[model samples]
Target: MVYSHSQVQLYKQCELRYAYKYIDRIPVPAEASLHLALGTSVHGALEFLYKEVQRLKVPSKESILEEYHSIRNEQITKIQEENKRSQLDQQQVADFAHMGVEYINWYYSTYHPFDQSIVMSTEEKVFPKLDDDIKFRWQIDRIDTQDDTFTIVDYKTSKRYPKDTDETFKDQINLYGRAIKQNYGSKFKKLIAKIVYLHLRNEIAREVTDEEMEKTRIKYSSIIQEIIKKTQRRSNGDKEAFKPVQWYRCDSCPFKMICPLFAHNYIHDEAVNLDDMKPTTIKAVIDEMAQMAYEIKRLKEQKDSYAKILGNYAAEKGYKRLYGNENKVIIGKSENYSPLPEKKNELESKLASENMLDDVVDIDRFKLTKKFKEHELDYDQYQDLVKKSVSITAQRPSKLKEKEIDEYMDIIGEE
Candidate 1:
């Protein structure tokens, strides 16, 4: 049950995805987007450049940039090939490659390439758990010892930087800081955990406070417990509990077709002859429907109330007076109620006929807040339940007969 920050993030995204990727050993397709490949190439180049600087005390950024440029064409070609195979737009591939170059440039300019001394660049640093049962591991990007303090530097190519006030970033950085503390102990005078958002052209450095470390320790402990529970349930052959909770992000997920929610949606669409859906989206549609339902209910009530008031006003004015005659008292309902239903039915029928209704109607399977009673289960317990329910099912035995084996034995005949 080894877990890292990235694994934790994946689990939070979708337990079934984590199971597919890590537990079930499903192969994730190689990321072939220009942006993705360029990011990888840039990271590699930076690692190389920094390692050289660490060893030789100086490395030419211009030379590194030149080398990157030389391979840039090849990288673009590779990305284009991948895009062709994957059916990704060529424009997106080009955009991503350009962004990657920008990110590299950002990194070079921010660090002043040659000005900063590389204390430990691209080191394969690890943080092993203090407890033998908890085999938590983290490979930090770089550890730069500047002046009296040490900074754990992590490079990011994301366009947006996590705000300093963002809770998620706080948790992530704090966890990294805790890992550093747990591994290094008191070796460094001061430990600063920093995330360098290359694309955003900003850096965030947060000191490993005692409180933050404690929180990190508690968080990892809970994460480990959930992992153990998931493993236990997996070993016990509890398959039904492991159905994946379909989400909006599943659109980008490779296992969406295999996932129960997605599969169900796919089947419904095919059966009904529906239009092509976005494939991996579920939550957004559900949320939208929920909002629409709420709005519809609210609008109905509001319209009724408004109609009543208008009817009263018309009655007070006497229908003829309201209509500018001032003699006959005409009584009538303010507006028609049946029109709403007619419109709704018309839309529904059109969608059903076009087979687009299933895409709009398929609901999210995981309703955590609705299903679980408040304070009845903690966060870890809830996460464990999610993991337990999303375990990969075992394959059924084939019903077909076995093929006959042929043996080549001619020695006896020859004799």
Candidate 2:
């Protein structure tokens, strides 16, 4: 499959959206914004600045600002014409245009004369093949060369600057570095990747090594393989293969009305003002259930908080049972075991070899403990089969007969 970094990121963000876009070939209307116009204008002005430098000509800061303003206004006019309900008013559009001009002026001042390196290309598109069938198609924002070393530079207009240790930006530049090496390996001696944050007026850079590139290749190749396999499964009648991953981006997603994960929310929202034709409405029931669920969650948090306090108090006092006026709280220990999924098959196989898999469901710890109590296995054998940990729990006994409480207390004492 021919993919780009953005396409791969979209797949990782939400499989259902990727399927709707790439697999189903669904067309979504584009929404225009002043922010996008500002970003595009800044990129265009910088491209003009660097391209002029390649010709032994350095454009003045005012000229670059003019280019930025022209680009911004053209886009803003188109956006207003197409999107009547656009949230960008005249003031917002003017502010964004001014911001674009500032970004261009800042960038031009920082890299004046533009002679640090030779410009190889701006907005160059490349197709790099990982294998015979797996390929990537992406665009490099800019490439510069200095003494056999190549630098891949990407422009960012985001308000939030990336941290020094941000892996996402690093991975993107690393991938671009690999593309350059693949295309011009004979001419390249070293690689450097950078993301220039025009808004924040700072940049993050990395020196790329061959070893890191290989690791990145393997990582993304594995993810692409998984996407392919899941796509095939989804095509072959497995409806659950590509499930929706609801996240912050869902609000801006055009496919949310059809996504199984959030379609019900849209339905409920639309039905909130329906006429009350019956004594009990479905919306009312759903609202009540939602409230109940919230209440249950709140109460669970409170109960867990109290349980922790009670458990700690009992431990400090060396008391297994704390008596209240109407109820008694018991502090006890329970054994728990949870085997990793990959280790389950080997564990079950070992148990079957010893003829101890009978009546055991999914390696249930309680059933295994019962078998141990019945003397079906020795202490060492049971311990080997399941590693157990004891956790203290606080339980309150209320509305219980004295005889029932005595029996429960006796059982706990014996254990």
Can you write out model 2's per-residue Cα lDDT over 59-78, one digit (the tens) per residue?
A: 89988888887888788778
Stretches of candidate 2 exceeding 4 Å from the true structure: 268-281, 284-415
* TM-score of each prediction: 0.60, 0.69
lDDT of 1 by residue, 115-141 (tens): 564466475556546256665566667
RMSD (Cα, Å) for all candidates, in order, is 17.4, 14.0
* Model 2, C-alpha of 115: deviation from truth (Å): 0.7
Model 2 lDDT, residue 235, Cα: 88
